[model samples]
Target chain A: MFLESKRGILFVKPMADVPSLTISPSSKESGEWVQPSPPRPLPISSLRTLTIRRWFWWVGVSLVLAVVTLLTCLGFGTESISFSRIWFILVGVMLGTESIHVGTDPTAVILLQVRLPRVLLAFFVGGSLAMVGVALQALLRNPLADPFIIGISSGAALGAAIALLFGVGISVWSVSALPVCAFAGALLALLIMYRISSLGHGFSIYTLLLAGVVLNAIFSAFIMFLTSVADPNRAFGMYAWLMGSLTGPDFFTLGVLALYLGVGLMVLATQAQSLNLLTLGEETARSLGVEVERVKKLVFIAAALLTGAVVSFSGIIGFVGLIVPHAVRLVVSADHRLLLPVAGFVGGMFLMLADTVARTALSPGEFPVGVVTALVGGPVFLYLLTNRSMRVGM
Target chain B: MVDSKNVFSGPAYALRDVTFGYATRAYDQSESVLKDLTCSIDSGKILGILGPNGSGKSTLLKLLARILRPERGTIELFGNPLSLLFQADVARRVALVPQETMQVFPFTIAEMVLMGRFPHHRGWGGWHWEDAEDWRIAHKAMEDLDVTHLGSRLVTDVSGGERQRAVIARALTQEPQVLLLDEPTAFLDLHHQLDIARILRRLNRERSLTVILVSHDLNLASQYCDQLMLLHHGHIVEVGSPQDILRPDLLETVYGCQVLVDRHPQSGLPRVSLPV
Candidate 1:
């Protein structure tokens, strides 16, 4: 390494033939240096191609994994259904030709109505949270930044609790009560953070992060207070929801979530190049033609919407957003064009698999997927922090 | 006669009675860093701004790039008031390379340079993929800055001089009519510094790139800059050719130090050396 660096230093001295001490600027011609060299395969350009190819490879693998996970999750409920039966039923349902009586084969109703929506919702929520995570990390320009760390998830949780405990909205089919309330809560927290952080120079990421920590604590306390005042049955429901369950939402809820995530992902993916420039630093991004304030607002709103939509249903599944992006970044480059979608796919598969474990771990009782994620995520985050390569990259 | 309406008729940048300061809060006004400073930089001239630490050299560059809004006066870019142009419009024509950058995330040097083409990509929304021509321009920039070998390396992993060169390469990819650099040579070794000086000189002569640089290296400023603008405590002490500005008394007054100014042995540009 030393020898290579020494040679690099020597190579940087303009002309290699001239001795180091006696080199003169007049020896070089101006126009000559501006000319592009004969197109040799530069390591940099080749590395770029390699990265793009590797990204495509990861995307293909993750897509296959997502499908496999979706199929595998269908078979792992309290009452075990064979994989072939699940596959047959799924294919028949999709074709809309074969009908199985729910009365005769109770497994059919359980698979179609109960397990299918839960599994799909888990995947969608996971993907949404991961998307939010990737966008927030880039927007804040910090590797450790995620929706939970920035209070978006907690704020959404508080909103969901208020709606669940106090009955804040009428039960509407088009826009569900919980998600709407949660979305409002998330946006409120976002507005407060923006206002407080923007007090000094634009948006100070440290101040925003500190504000998020404080808000998260405050919101969680409010949730606790609400849980205490509620009746026993409602309090039990609140505890389960707070633990992050995917059991309650129906197909309609899933559809609403998928629609919101789809739009949010598109908006975020469009700003991928801007996100790339932003990672360099706000000043550099501004100098490179990014309207820093505008991009920040767009990214913040999109990330908050994604987190609220998912948290409203899933009750704040932690670490999918924080962990999946870092894991994807390890394999793929940090180009948001690839990073956002890849993180989503990987996150979907991961949470689906986690949900499967949660369903089968205690047979009928079922652990919360949030508990599984934290149990899994905590070690991984600590490892990432301690790992030399990851720390340096960060 | 110079046509008055032509874009090249007047100075590339004109700052008239400009007073600027950073705001401490949304409503709180901080003290002014620069006060009533007026200067004009003509087209294709290499103007080196020399000043001590905290003398507002970087602030001046930021003001020219329109990063900071002035509290008092008007700054004109190519005869148009700065307020008349959009931020993107200013970025398309002017590129500023700051002294040091904090990059919390890692990126390849090529990727870093490619970002400089942000303003040139013609699209309103969605992923603005760089075309083949953009890549060609970026590669040419790397070659010009002599950093092609470091292109694949992470920007955070390279030596300070290599990083400096890579940043300059990125600035070149902007293809700006004017390039403003703040302490571009501060981290570079002597040879790399000279290389940068020659490269800037070439770009000015061949491409008609109006260049403005801030530096603490007086000898370098004297050697390469066509004109020197000496600033002391946010005020311009002198603005003239190197021979006229690189004088013992003027530099001593501004710098508060004793110095000897003589012609270079070979180049005939003024050489500033401290008496030992």
Candidate 2:
């Protein structure tokens, strides 16, 4: 019937065209399909469900990955040392057993002070970035969406550039101001984008994505101008940051990042249900009793905080935020219960792994982790993008 | 579980001659999306809004949901003005089921459906086993929609028709006073469309749930709606019971197409046919 009526019937199946008189429409439907059903999360109710227990697998793997990442990061650096000595050195540092030197005095110090901090930063940053990826992906409702796409990274860079070059005299007690600057910038950009894309009625993702690209370019240009005008010394520091390094940031910065990341992560994770509804779009989300705007505001703040803090301290570590969330979604589905946390774990491990390779790929000189992320993520992302499943509009 | 009479027990919803428009761009001058639109909904009985494309069907729904601020009007939901309710408070009374059915994110059906409980819920925890009841309600909604088997399957992997039902299931999980569905059957085949129609009918009759649906399917509207509103160029063209409004003249004026209206043999509801 379809082929007879339409000229552009590119392909047709016998069953698709012919519904025989003998077979009723109701009878043709073999399965007793459930209609609009309720949400049932990963069943963790009993030990019997342990094998299929997805969270347990993530937790078990995360611990092992974290430990291995820690050791490998310490083991290979400017002066490569044995794995045993690296472990002993780490134990000594933890236990305050400062007497065991495995080889050169310089290598031991480098292992303890230089490599260890960088590696741990990678792990923690990875974890935080991935989790933020999950949150932002759910919040935005576009798989291609990320913290960067929303202009959070650009805003953070702007805030950091002003602080570093102009030496914005925010006192030590207002020490929280540096990251707060980044978070504020992110929130401000997000507000503008939201307002512009959603004037009245529903949001158009194409318009939003286009808006983001324009905003990103504008901010990137501004940052470039800041770099060009700054003193040579400041320019060098800015260069390191723009390329994204895991080098600087003291423990105080870590403490602050942890605090903000913790609060944001908790908030996003708790609203996992809303995030789930959001994937169905705003109207549906609201009907499901989600305070759509409030959820939007909270998730944006959380995503901005996560993105802003990371960019402020570690500089712009690109692709981890973009890649980690997609990876997690493919493996675990968009159910935020698992998606949010797993994105974090996977992100942490991925960054740690990337940073480990970056630091050791060439012993004396260091490579930027962003390059590694893009190199790894580009191919994988391409595969997902061109896949048959996504051809239909979401 | 909600009683219909209690919904408008003391004047639940009010919209006072609101006007909305978009600013002029280079190509087009300022234009109104909703022109002096004034309407109110009672607590019970599903309200069906029928219109052609670009006729402000979505604009009307957005105003009610408060996602988009109306340009020049006052909207009151359940006695309190829209401005009076906290963001959370408004969400408790109304829920919207949007049109986009294709889901890119692979949310499990359970997690997707539990989102309906967000207004009734608070705080920021990942998933509390203690909130097991919310999960149960979501599961029940899924069952009500007959989508229980697709619970574990990635939402991305499902058929378009199945995904649409899943989205509606999520909305049902919200347990709202009013349910607003925009193009609910836009993505479904005939079988699923009828299934949704039946489910919606049951919810309206049994629960007294107020349903406001924006659809292109005039037949479905005539069959299910207590009231049918015709819209054209962002204005309500005609409104009344299906029998009164489903005339050929108004249908042509609003839709810009030839339409034939006939009475159904058994139900006596208006049935519509369009030109090929």
Candidate 3:
């Protein structure tokens, strides 16, 4: 209510009043006529109450787009299925009215067992990576910060490569060996980075970034060595996995990934306000009553968990994490409470579409989804870097 | 409104032989920043800490704000040990406005100001949004700083003076009993510098706010500060009223270059100027 009058006055005031308030001697001497433009209306509140409402509206729109993308992507494989049949199949399966039999209708089996799981996997993985991107960017206070750039993905890949080389997943009881190892690798990398950065009293962003770069190089070399010594067939499979193919994921695997992502995302959600403060600078955040040390540690761990889990499932898909958050920030404000969720949804939709294009663009033979993401995301990232206006609040 | 009556019933801050240093590579030694600093600031007074660069002015302010811990001695805030209080508790009572801020996100001026309400949020782990009362307080602070019109503008996009005012407004939104500022008018133009000093003085008189600002501008500090504490090489050279501290010999000894010290013709406050 207070903001309404303030907003009214701001609008009703003549445009000339704005420039007159900031008149300088140089401007008067230059004799250049100052342009009169209305001042931007202050948001309804400083506490982001109106921005929160706008975020919810975006969330609703994103949810609809997600559903549409899911259904549309499900229809576009080598065996193209009509939207009506796909919808019926999904609804029937949800309703338990139609039984899925491989012999009777192979399309239902393919749709339910193959396309659905992969599409959902893509969504979850993309969402997780994007959330990690937002968290890391805030944590480091650098716009270029992402899971892939910071070497977390390389650590996970190295772990997965080790698992594949050792045939750890072949054992009946250890089907989750690859993901578990990958998670451990990612945590190890994060721990090392933390230790190195904290050696100088507190976490130094420069040292952390340098350690990441060094660790990435080391881990990638180890992964290469492991791949070279392994059997040809297994090595080829590892190569495909390393290139980030979203294929052959079952519902059980999807459920496990979802569980990990859900927990990690909840932890991040709780820290949204603190992250907003942190972006202002650590000292400033502390003076504003944030426990900077504790916040940094928790966010680092949460980001690592999200990165490790997603990389374990979908190998090192690049740019979604970096690009999605920036795009979302452009649309929405940098308030993490809004940025995190909206970016998550947008990322999920983006990856789903990319995966669709990856699978169907060249019929019968599918390339890795990583290629698709990199192709699009790399150029966009460069554009963001070069375009001064597109720089993320820096 | 802040209670004008002395709620704590003592000096705002009492430091007992406080020493602080940054740890160096050698385990046996540290780079000492502040050495055996003992001082007490009276309640509801504006105290200025003046020194050359690296004379530990900012470090002293940081110690008072509890952003850094003293390696030796004790700091008491309103008769209670500062070390005993939690950071959030300290923040609710004491707010700090740094010399300058480097923001990595484009938060609006209003949003930046409202961040001062962080310490006052009521919820589990303080995970709640600011209520209507908080918003009202933030709006009032913005109006006081004359930044209400620029509330929607991004902090990074505003002029240096507007940004500084927004920072001060944020500190005000904290509803602090004691305010610590590092170079409150370092890069500000003369108009904004006077504007900021006047605002602090008004707040001090109206709310009985205790303000300790670290500054290098001797004239501004002499004009506005109720008391001046001069430091040289991590040690206090003198602590007295502006008339006593702004002496030519003492200022020259502390600053190594200052010369002229005279009364301002208008305010009659001691003013310091360099001789060419």
Candidate 4:
């Protein structure tokens, strides 16, 4: 009665104070729809925050770490350079000051040729993978939608395996063919998953996920069988690469990856609005006059290119792609436009830090950079799933 | 330009031998949901289609939206083949507020409402100032529906009634010539039911839009719609003013229940009540 009177009064003259929109506590109305509110703590926001607040911060950390990782790759092993003399060696090289040869000859060669390229490769690959993960998460609107979980990593591995067995990846890629072949393999797997999942009317996320799981299993089986039968020498290289290494990459290869990943990241960042709209489902996307399918294709292709390119070179570095974007989204908000670039920068920083740890952790010896990424990322990914999935999915 | 001089004064939509079915599998189009159903909705009038569960009210709406193509028969929109109108073009003619829908992501009320202008927008850059005029029209609609304050609220955060209005705001954003709704007021309270009906009535009177909606609440439909289509087992059995359609025997035959039919004091249309 009291509510009726208030409503009656407002019926004549609408109030400015009340929220203009309100749905009643009318459970009798929803015939069957009783969707329980899910848990909260959206990854998109955190990533958005990380993307904004931490981009420069992470980049600064990355910049210092880049130099340190590069130097450490020279010094930490059997070829250790002094902390003090390393600076001048770098300065001498940069300035063409041939007179200031403060360091031993072996350390200088190690720093300039071997360590620098390897560290830089880690930075580019890590950053590219992270950005790809972010792009896929936004495009698929599923947090679990990373390259590894959805089997994209295995796809690249399978491609690399096929190429490696035939010695064709090295031939076709000239220098980058393994990476290129791996990328193609990943794209092929993802496309197959997409085709299987599309049920004619519209794309269902549930179907896409189910398809990923099945395909991943199949690809993993094929890879294990292939690995189990490989020749011992090639198998050692394959296993080491599968675990992921930033131990030794040629400088020319690193530069090419840097350039390619840079272009991929830029393309993704520009399509942020379309990706953001897509998070709301295709009907809403369509109602807005967006060619929903076209945008999906573009985002998928870009993310695939990113994953393929990074994987082709890095040989499947795990969880960095899965965790970095999520960690970034938790801070920023679900706005993909900001999320993609921020994820890219943070991704670079994360890989650089991981490689530094990989170089330092088992010092004098080395662990693969991919192993360190899993070591860092897996626990973080698990924590996020338990704590924030409800909010992220909602 | 449409030949306005020869405009038909009858129902805006006519369905002849329409059939449809849910896709249980890739090949299962056999058990048609709406088996050779036929119906018509006249222009500038609020027509309500009422039936029991699975009686094909929703299938009828989807067929009209062309979201589902009928297995057979023609659905004429504004007395023209529905196919002649593009999905976007028909979207401009009729806007829909679907039932049992939930959004998984956040979009602001204004943004959701602005989506309605899609059919009107041209060129690839998306939403122009003239589209802003559509926004203004949507704003006016939100104001009239008492939902103007929800402009900035995220559609995902709001309650059902608020969400419905935002959706209607979306449809209004389309600046549609006709509106097709599937249970628009299902989750709303009594006041909102009246509020939605009044808004539809106003749009009909002001714009001469052909408003075809499927509603479960016979009383609300009785109070609002100019005509009512009583459906049973995939067929529209009767069509008349609410007075003719809301009679006790007709309601009983259609719903398989006894309902009290009395004159509403306000509008003098028949009010339907379930026997307690």
Candidate 5:
């Protein structure tokens, strides 16, 4: 019956005169869709489920990639430990199913004692810095924000240098003096910067950046003074560490770093929703019932602790914090719920890869991990500066 | 209605001898922005605040939203002194849609509107990302503002008018007793202007929402607003219904310009036109 009407045999109009239904209503109506009522907003439950699924997808992918990268790093290095031997030692020790003598194999000793600790330390430092980066970016409401940009890491390096130069870091209660001093220095710098930037009623981005630049200058000068006056033998080590190495940290220090990272990550993760609201702008966030001042205080201190702890051990590794979160954001939603955890995983993988290159790229001597991060990060930073879409939050 | 002593139970908002300014010395009397402003806005009515630039119209709206504190005198919201209420409590009852919003982070329109539910989800209630009820309210608000289609689009990627609609949707999600808007029509075209006005009118009638808007469009304000307040030089020059305040002489004196006033052809509401 509908076709007969369209054929216009029994209808008033002719069949050839029928307008094509295939043409969009837009092209039909004044050449416009005027009021093409959009579909009803997606159901909240569906959106929630969608994001949750996406979150898991990212976690799954990152987890797989991380496992592969870690396994690869474990096998390939200057010493070239056989994969099966390393695997046997790991499985046997973890499962306690097979006998493995550490004294019998030098490669096993190197793998279990030296290389494993270094790789684990690198992962923790990288992950903590990336988490700190995400938190600081949200706290400042500035996309360009990073621990290094704000000088938190520099303060830590200064503290570490003081401890090493003076030989004051005596092992106390299994906690080294260097990391403790470094954490203290990080907190101190954060406090000073916060005070200087908040001198006015509102937190000014300009003031914060300016204060960071000035503080970084002063601390670097102090570090230079210490290095210049130190004895020749110690000064060489100090300068190399200052260039941003991932060396000297033993398993005990790694355990302490893990404790700091775990606590900081928990604090930041619980406030993920608040951080999402905060990026909208302070006044808007407050109107939405966020205790703006309280959240700011919590995030600032947490980010500082994470950055400080990592910096104390790793010697002010730059760029991972700056590059990792921004890279993760390009692939995932900016919702902190997903951004934080994914960034942590990706950052760990990235630094482990970088460290592997640093150790193996040069056969006998290794380059500082910081140098590798900068060599990779400098281009990404330039791209962000040139990208028009990125200019919004800066 | 003009008599100060002829008071009903209470209006949605009551301002008594309210004074405010920004960064002025305590002793500098000339620096005050809104000086001795007194008025009452009734529930379920649209109040259009009209004034030239720098005439303290925006300042008055901000004071009402509690974005700024009054330097002197008291402002009451539903019979309670605004000063005595907690910030979140005030936010629950009142919402302000600023003239413009800047977002540095990229968020989908859906996520942006969900933020409106923030005030309602307080204490331990917000622990779960957002409840089903919150999403339902946000969805309904987007539907009301005719922005449900743009829900999945990035806010920065949409047009200015679409973004404005989304912002209005967010304010609706707040579900407040009083809605304060600064230049709601500034970025919209003719169709959207009327669409927004109709939405406000429907909300007023259906939900008994009290709307206070700051607008530069004289005719639009005259046609839709139940009452109008004309401000000049940190003071309210006139406050009355559209017919009483739409006079050419009063507009000229306040605007410092020449203008014509006439009845709209269809609605018979008084319309102000610039005789070019």
Candidate 6:
């Protein structure tokens, strides 16, 4: 039945012509209506289910891939170490059998002390950023949402710049102080954006996004002004950090980062089902028994925490958060329970590879890992936008 | 399991002096959408709310679904104040099928339907995963809605009528005693509209589900609803059976347009039409 109005004419096909609405046997049983069955199911392949077993399978595969990527990237720095030696060193350290003195052997020192910590840091930071990306995207109901675009990274960067400008020494206190300041900055940004967006009772996604963009610009200006006024020697270091570098993190720093990321990821994981419901719509989620306000708050804090933790140590790495989750969603289903873990592993692997290239591509002189991600992420983002099959709208 | 039909002994919903308004930019003033409404909806009955645009029909349905709170009055569900009940508790008894929803991700129809079981999950930690029984109920809802074949299809990729069925299937999976629909047939064709009406009637007969729907289709409402209510300017103009409420004078006043009222030729139900 076509509907014609003064505004325009809408030609709706007759019910008999629409295959999806064809009368079914069950409906026919209720009355005298008889119609042909719906045509063969659309040729599109059915979406793969993430059963408990399949979820575990995919997670295990991604975990193995991440570990392999870590180990492989460890073998790439200035002084490349053979995989066999790296494996031996790992086993020796774990089993406590080989008394390989790290100070005496440069290879062991590089593999265990320098390279090992760096790779592990990369993995944790990457995983944290990606997980937060997935959460933020779900929270905002925008697939493009990520820590960097939403200003959390710049907020952390601003905090770190202040700490450095004040000449916070590299003592144990400074070690804790830098991250504390960054986390504080991230929380402040989160609160400000949340307040601005939620002024009308509930969050408006457009308002939240606009606030994030504006906050990012303001934070960047503050960071630039601080850097310009600081000493050139310190300003150089700040510049590199602003560009997002993962440089020389120790085991203690890695452990602390792990703790923060662990807590944040656990909080996000517990809200996985709620996240799935939220993607449908806030009212729909509320009707489905989800506490929409509570879930939003929890996810916001957790995402801020994860972003701050990673940005504090790794400076502002871009694209791992935005790209990894999106790519994983394409391969796996959108079920947050599976998407979260899988995206984390893939992100870890992605950043590890990017950092490896950054460190090794320029010989002894290394560039910021953020440069590599931006170079790769920029093109990939464009491709996703232009490619019809990417379907990145969500 | 106990039958939900036997669980509730009184009216499904009762609103007393219920008033709702949207706060405008002016701090001291507000625009009232529903004003001082008092009504009681019986169980196991289909109630259709009819009104012109902006008449608060949808707001009334939302209030009954517990999705909105009245500004100055009380709403009771199953003899208990709606405000006193937990959100999940309210959801478990009352399910709403919105006219449309924005889908940010491509969730499979089965996954979408399984979400209806969310209110049934136990525990405050939010760690509950859907078990076999949840899947069974979801599957059964799909079968009942004749959407079993669309289980693997994405809700975003389907036709409007199919998506509507999928959404209704999800609502059915909630296994609620009362179902609230906001313009369920607004965008549907005649066949699909009839299909939806039949499904609602069947559910009402089988499970004693109380259905309250808001619609502009006067003819469809008259054909399906046992009780009809007309509203104008946030006030209830008339509430009665189709025959009593579908009078030309009442509809003309509520809708602000002249309408010809006649009986449906086959069913003898009230039929409304615009006299061109």
Off by over 4 Å in 3: A1-52, A99-103, A167-175, A191-213, A389-394, B1-6, B25-32
TM-score of the second chain in candidate 5? 0.92
i-RMS for every candidate (Å) is 5.5, 8.8, 5.5, 10.7, 10.0, 7.5
Which CAPRI tier for candidate 3? acceptable
Q: Write the per-residue lDDT of candidate 2 for residues A85-182, one digit (tens) a residue.
A: 88777677679756433435676777766676677778777887777767666665656666666576787888877777777775466575667777
**Over 4 Å off, model 5:** A1-50, A82-84, A96-104, A162-215, B1-9, B16-19, B24-32, B36-38, B71-74, B80-86, B123-127
Model 4 lDDT per residue over A1-394, tens place? 2322232233222333333343446754765555443222122121111123444565465457555655554455456677766786778788886332344676677777766676668768877887788777766666657787678888988887888877783654356566667778888887876566455535455566677778888987987788789888888888887777776677677777777677677677766666665665555554444566676777677777777777767777888878877666544334565566566666776887788778777767778877788778778766655653234333
**Candidate 2 residue-wise lDDT, B172-216, digit = tens:** 877777788899998888888888999999998898788999998
Reference-based TM-score of each model: 0.87, 0.79, 0.89, 0.73, 0.85, 0.89
Model 4 docking category? incorrect
What is the Cα-based lDDT of residue B106 in candidate 2? 53
Q: For each candidate in the order shown, give its overall lDDT on alpha carbons.
A: 0.79, 0.71, 0.81, 0.69, 0.78, 0.80
Give every candidate's TM-score on chain A: 0.82, 0.80, 0.83, 0.75, 0.84, 0.83
DockQ score for model 4:
0.16
lDDT of 5 by residue, B1-276 (tens): 022222435798999999997776444444439999888889779999999998998888878877778999899888878888766677777888888776766567788888787777665314346667877898899889887656665666678898889888888898888899999999999999999999999998898899999999988898889999999989999999999998999999999999998899999999888988
lDDT of 5 by residue, A1-394 (tens): 2321222222122224324346565578767644444453444443322255677898899889887777678777778877788788778668976433344567777777778778888888888888888988787776666788678888888888898889784567667787778877887887787666445434445556677778899999999999899998898988887777887667777788899888878888878878887887666666666767778777777787787678777787888887898877655667788888888988999999999999999877889998899899878766665767655533
Candidate 6's residue-wise lDDT over B9-92, tens digit each?
A: 889998899999877654333354899999999989999998888888888887877777789999988888888876778888
Error of 5 at A2 (Å): 47
- Best-to-worst ranking by lDDT: 3, 6, 1, 5, 2, 4
Looking at model 3, the pairs that clash are: none
Model 2 vs truth, CA RMSD: 7.5
Instruction: Give the per-prediction TM-score of chain B.
Output: 0.92, 0.90, 0.94, 0.89, 0.92, 0.94
Q: What's the C-alpha lDDT at position B22 in model 6?
A: 75
